[model samples]
Target: MSTTTTTTTKQGHPPGLYLLFATEMWERFSYYGMRAIFVLYLTQALLLDKNVATDDYYGSYTGLVYLTPLIGGYVSDRYWGNRRSILVGGLIMALGQLLMFISASFYQNFSVSHNVMLLGLLALIVGNGFFKPNISTMVGQLYPEGDSRRDSAYTIFYMGINLGAFFSPIICGFLGDTGNPADFRWGFLAACAGMVVSIITFELLKNKYLITPEGGAIGGTPEKVAQIEDNTPKRSISENIGWAIGALVLAVAFFYGANIDLIGSFIFSLSIIAPLYIILDKSLNREEKERISVIYIAAFFVIAFWAAFEQAGTSLTFFADEQTDRVVFGKEIPASAFNSINAIFIVLLAPIISIIWVQLAKKGLEPASPAKQAFGLLFLSIGYLVIAFGVKDLNPNVKVSIMWLTSLYFLHTIGELCLSPISLSMVNKLAPPRFAALLMGVWFLSTAAANKLSGTLGALYPDEKLIAAGKIPSIFGFQITNLYEFFMVFVVFAGVASLCLFLLSFRMKKMMHGRG
Candidate 1:
């Protein structure tokens, strides 16, 4: 029973590892930069109205963004090889970013032209489908299987993501929304520039990192002579044609999700899940089935967590806008600015937490996997409670200060630090090697599903406002007219899910059969 682990001594592996880090850093700068403004632009600048269309837009955008990584991951693992796939994905995404800039420009001219916006959105969704998975896969390939540093590597990688997200809102939000079109142009340009910067850095370092993964390029310009996997599936023309139709049909279904309600959304999600489930069920062995079962179960708990957690972008943002007082030392800040708090917290706390996890793991005092996840959920739930307390304290005429919101964000960030990245690493490690990337895809599919639900939950609160504030719709027959009431329900949901996971951990561990 040899259990030898791979090690990447500080000087070991290629110097290019850090280059990829830098590349990823800039790409995040582009992504979060755009994300910070996308919603604001839609509601405020473009005036699309916030109720149904807004959540749909967010759900569709974020869900599809996550879902495409499956296609990207499979293309890399089975056909393109990681490096080539990464390059292709990066270039595609870069083009998409420029297209998005064009979109903003068109928006400036046409204001509410749906066609331009749709095209830009399509470009981004498609481009992200290619980029996200490939880049993460590249990071994993930088180390051997079971590498001790892999967790740290991902932490570092995640940090790169957060650091960019942390700054993008501050900079892009400032520039893009700086009371003039000139500032907006600079913001969009900064996004495009950051992506290009990342792409160039990636290209330079591609060769060095290729030292171990040892595969030739697979995708770039259509002209380049690149190698494909020798056994890349040679589907018959009829089968390929059938798949094309199936994909089109599936795309149509999800595209409709942009306009439909929970029923339509659920139908679309089930369309993806049902077929995949039947295939996995019918094809895999007992052990494999059980392993995937854990993954799926984990998926549900994740949905529970994300439904609560994702309120940060939607419901929480709205709360900050209407209810929470934004007086930071007597000067008011925009509600959207609070959205940056979680990323900022991550940038500051991630390294310290990562080090603690590593040290604890080495000492055998690290909490078991399920417990950690449960802990994350607990914090998230508690965070909502913390905010609710602030609401309780405010006088009829007086408002709570920004510090309370920041405090709540700190708790949610702690929960996120515990749950999110840990889950990614867990998926990569626990999945059977043969189906590694696909399992990762399934993992992200969970994210896709969870995100869609997150949007719905944003709309799911009570109208505590009309009853409590003015004429506003309740999310779930409850008057969300009050920010505290809306957020508290989600927080409570997360806490309950955490407790359930905690109680079930021992049973789940038994089923894991030591695989975890």
Candidate 2:
């Protein structure tokens, strides 16, 4: 069996890291730019109801976006490989963006526009499935096993992701989210251009830079490499099929019992099933299974974190639009631009956070990955708590100071710094080489569930019209009559999840077998 090797660099990291960084930056720019205006375009241009747009359309779209990575990962592991999958996915996404531009151009004809937009979204979801996991998995391959710089490298890569995210909303929102609906096409066009840049950048540079230390090309087709054989006894095909069938039945039951829509139920079901399938692989020994278990456990906790954090795209965006004071130096800021705050904070703070991790590492005092993630959930809860208090006792018609929303974003950025990149690095460190991309896809599966839940929670946003009609929104038996109660819901979810993960961190650290 052969394994990938890492190159030494005077800058403390390989040059390939920077190449991947620039590639991912533009990809994120395309993704976040389109996302910044998706809901606004649906509601304002297509004139869909808020709840319908968020719960049915946006939830389903984003959920599927994450869900299909399972298929992409499997295909990559068996056939396409990372480089080919990324190129194909990028081209597809670029086409998706062009379709969106056309959809926005035809916004006046709702039926035509809606159908075309759906097709475009389908393209984006499928493309992202191929693109997301492969790129992330490649980042881990850039370093050898147990390298101290791995975590810091991921943090730096995360900053690249945010750099793109930070500018996208400002540019996209400025072009598309102006009061007039006709301008949405310009935003989609810009996103299309970003995707094109991403594709070209990767294609031009990958052969030169995406290589192992010995100058062997990385992420080549799986068949081209000599692989370690998994000789452990495996489940019979019939038995495996039986398990899959059982999982599907449970998914349907959940759909009906939980009253979540089809997409939500599907995402939630696969989030569990996919991880279980990987764990059941007969090739994994006791230690490998335990380490993988930690990934699954942390992923479960992450669902809670992102369900709250992702409100930035839906409920939080609504709050910024309707409730926050957006006036700045005598001009009103576009609500969609508020999406940039978290990303901008990430760009500013990621370096400091990266430095802290390195400094702590040198002294053998760095917190374990699980402990760091718990702190992330804690900060997320605190962020919501701050906004909950700000919204307390306020009249529905009266706008609160923008500072409240900014504070929430600032805190959430800290939480994101703690959790998101760490989880990515954790998956990379803990995953076996053969299962690398597949496990990355499983990690994203949790995000699929969270994004769906975010939409479900976003639907619970207290609409003033609904409140006036004497119909208050509720979740898990708690009534949300106002913005304060709504915000508190997240506070409770994240706080409880943080506590639970904290208690489990000690055990999970032991499971890692000293890897962290």
Q: Which window of 10 residues has the lowest lDDT sum in candidate 2?
A: 1-10
User: What 10-residue stretch in candidate 1 is worst by lDDT?
Assistant: 218-227
Tens digit of lDDT per residue, candidate 1, span 338-364? 768998899889988888888887898
- Winner by TM-score: 2
In model 2, which residue pairs have backbone atoms overlapping below 3 Å? Answer: none
**Cα misplacement distance, residue 290 of candidate 2 (Å):** 0.4
TM-score of 1: 0.83
Q: Estimate each model's TM-score.
A: 0.83, 0.96
Question: For candidate 1, what's the RMSD?
Answer: 5.0
**Model 1 lDDT on a 0 to 1 scale:** 0.67
Local distance difference test, per candidate?
0.67, 0.89
